[model samples]
Target: MKTVLFDYGNVVSLPQAPEDVARLASYVTGAEPGFEDRYWEVRLDFDRGSLDPAAYWSHVYGRPMDGAGLDEVVALDVASWSRPNEETVAIVDELAKVGVPMALLSNMPVCVAEGIDTLPFMRPIGPRFYSGRMGLVKPEAEIFHETVAWLGVAPGDLVFVDDRLENVAAAERAGLAAVHFRDAAALREDLKTLLG
Candidate 1:
């Protein structure tokens, strides 16, 4: 069976708002200095599972977090990225109705992943592969290989959809067909062509 791999952040869920990040930065004790720059600086390691939540937050806040502080940061962090793109979600529903195998693969931290798990739209996912869980992130060849292996499908039998061109390119390099998702409308057309 052919399978479609979906990217979580921008493809299915709404992209994080800049204001949201700014709000979270305001709550961080030490984020006054280059808050946005700092967030992205350490984000890769955090998403790759090499840095645990506490360490990742500390790196962002410039101090160790107390239990309550940890909870707050984790909540805010997850909330910032949890908004759903209703249109793309509808597409997921359409695909599921027809039994098109679907799975999720995204670069995310454990806390965020756990929070998103409770969302209604996340229920149809199969064989989810998060960077936090897989220790692999998109645009990396290994992740594509691992995903294909886990799905028990050949690369040609899978289609990967992601918002980032680099990620789409990487999947292509790894031998999987990919769509650079610009919007839900484009995605619907792309999937039709691929699945047809």
Candidate 2:
């Protein structure tokens, strides 16, 4: 009730990396996977430390790519981060002003997450739990439980917002109130109802 954990990417402002994933994907499957989740499915493990980038690229791209080639793909993947939402930023500020602490928990790459930490939107939030740093990812029991432990709050008292239903499900199963965030509006309403 006092602290809310937000998923990064959409909730917090992040830089847009270049997009080579699409180009690679098109070459691989003849159809580009342009969205965040599609690209993320392949990338999340690497970002979360569950898989190495070289191994992942080897499996996905059909061959191992050098660091540069891997970065090209990751840049494109990070670029999928859309522009930040001003309204959400405002709400975060408002919530902070009310003495409600906000923390960021994201399934993000170390490089990308570190880059995001330098941005203005992340300034008010507490130390971000980037999967890379934690060696865990969302929709997984360890990460969710680790987040709860790191926050020092009971799961039942914390609320988690993510864009994935599976993530929401995991959070709920762990005893946290969960919201599958759609947009600033939906997030606004969910926070009001839960935190009101």
Candidate 3:
């Protein structure tokens, strides 16, 4: 493989915790109960760029928020999704040291994408594609195809790593070799074998 494409959530960043989700639900449940369900119900639309940040938050809150309230909710929402998986990041650093070509592919909203861009770990990884920016999400053949085209590499020449089985399966269907990421140790082994 000439390049390695990585999924951000769970692969590089930590997965969302149940407690975190509950906390977010609590924040906006003033007018609406079941805020958690509402938050997730429209997440795909939010991540796919179909809903703006304000609209997405409004859906969660079940009411329109003023400028200050919107900014607060946006900041909290981004923080909830921004936790890093240190072990995975270390693996990425090792790959960088060895001169491996890598790029990021993440299902994220524009607000979260902007926040991730400012992260120290993400700064080194360029040409990252966010679903919100690409207007696509994972487990879809088109996102993989579009990423391959953007990287100027053939699908067969690229290996994708994602924590989700469905996303890994989709990458294989899209003609890219894929790794179902479980831990950094396994990822190290996979990369060694693939790059050998």
lDDT of 2 by residue, 1-196 (tens): 5578888765655334444434557644533544435445577777777776666656566556666777776555444554566777888888888888888888877766755676676678885788988988888889889888988899888878887789889989988888888888888899999998
Clashes of each: 0, 3, 0
Candidate 3 lDDT, 1-196, residue by residue in tens: 4688888988888888877776677776574467767888999899999999889888778788669888877877777778888998898888888888899888889988998888888755768999999999987889999999989988888888999999999999999989999998899899888878
- Checking candidate 1 for backbone clashes, the offending pairs are none
Which window of ten consecutive residues has the lowest lDDT sum in model 1?
28-37
Which candidate number maximizes TM-score?
A: 1
Better of 2 and 3 by lDDT: 3
Question: lDDT per residue, candidate 1, 55-168, as tens digits?
Answer: 988888888876998898899889888899999999999999999989988999888899988888988777788898889877789989998898888999989999999999
* Candidate-wise lDDT, in order: 0.88, 0.74, 0.85
> Which has the greatest lDDT?
1
In model 1, what is the error at residue 95, expressed in angstroms? 0.5
Question: Which residue runs of candidate 2 sit more than 4 Å off their true CA positions?
Answer: 13-41, 57-64, 67-76
Estimated TM-score per prediction? 0.95, 0.77, 0.92
Specify the poorest-scoring 10-residue window by lDDT in model 2.
Answer: 13-22
RMSD (Cα, Å) of model 2 = 3.9
